[model samples]
Target: MSYVTKEGLGKLRKELEQLEQIERPKITQQIAEARDKGDLSENAEYDAAKEAQGMLEMRIAKLKDIISNSKVIDQSQLDTSKVAILCSVKIKNKANGQELKYTLVPDTETDLKANKISVHTPIAKGLLGKEVGETAQITLPNGNQIDFEILEISLE
Candidate 1:
C-alpha cells in the first residue's frame, strides 16, 4: 500500500519514458561507438558504457515496479480530523517548546527540504491518527523519547 501523489506518479512516468526512449538510445550509441574503436578485450569506454546502461536499466525497472504498486491519493479525499498522508500537520515539541510543521508523504515523495516526511518515519508514525491537542510520544533513533502535541491538521 504505497501512497503517491498524482504529480509524483506523473514525474516517475515521465522519467521512465525518458530513460527508455532517450537515455537507453544514447547508451546504445555510446556502446556502438566504443565497439567501432576495436579491441573489445581492453576497451574501457565500452565497459563504462555497458555499466552505465546496466544502471540505467536497473533504475527503469525499479521505477516501473514502483509505478505498478503505487496508489494515487486524492487530496480532496484526505481527512483533516487527524494526521494522515498528504496532511499538513503543525505540532509543538513539549520538551523544547518549539513548533514545527511537516507534511506527511509517501516514501517516494518525501523531501526534507520541502518539509515532507515519510509516513514510515518514527515521527510521522507517531503523529498519524492523532488529533489536534493530543500528545504523541515517539522514540528517536538514538533511543531518546520526544513528546509532541498536535496543534493542527489541514489538507491545504
Candidate 2:
C-alpha cells in the first residue's frame, strides 16, 4: 500500500474523475467517428482509435487500483524527531556548499518542479532517520557519492 498526503489524494481523485468524465467520452466519440468511415477490415483510423482506447482504459484501471489501495497520512500525527516521509528537510551540500530543501513524498506524489522527491530516491534513502546536524552520504544513481548535512526538519 502507498501512503499519500491529503492534497495528493485529492489530486489523484480529480485526475481519475477527469479521465472517467471527459477523456472516456472523448475517446468514445473518436471510436464512433472512426466506425462511421466503414470497411472495418481495412480501416486504419478504426484500428488506431481502438488501440488508443485500450491504452486509456488500462491507464484508468491502474489509477483506480492505486487510489483504492492508497492511505492518506495525517501530518499532525507525525513526529518531528527524525527525518521521515512528509518531512520538509533542509540540507547543505558538503562539497559545493549549496543548500537545498526537499519534501520527501510517496512515488505518486513526487513533483520535481515543486521540490518534492520520491522517498525511494538515493538522496532520500540516505537521509532517512538522520537528525539535524548529521551528515548523510548518498550513493547516486550514477555511482557518485555526495555528502549532505541536515540543517533542519519541519512538518511543512
lDDT of 2 by residue, 43-90 (tens): 998898899899889989988998999999999998877899999999
TM-score of 1: 0.96
Off by over 4 Å in 1: none
Candidate 1 residue pairs in backbone clash: none
Model 2 — which ten-residue stretch has the worst lDDT? 73-82
Give all candidates' CA lDDT scores.
0.95, 0.94
Tens digit per residue, CA lDDT, model 1, 5-40: 999999899999999999999999999999999999
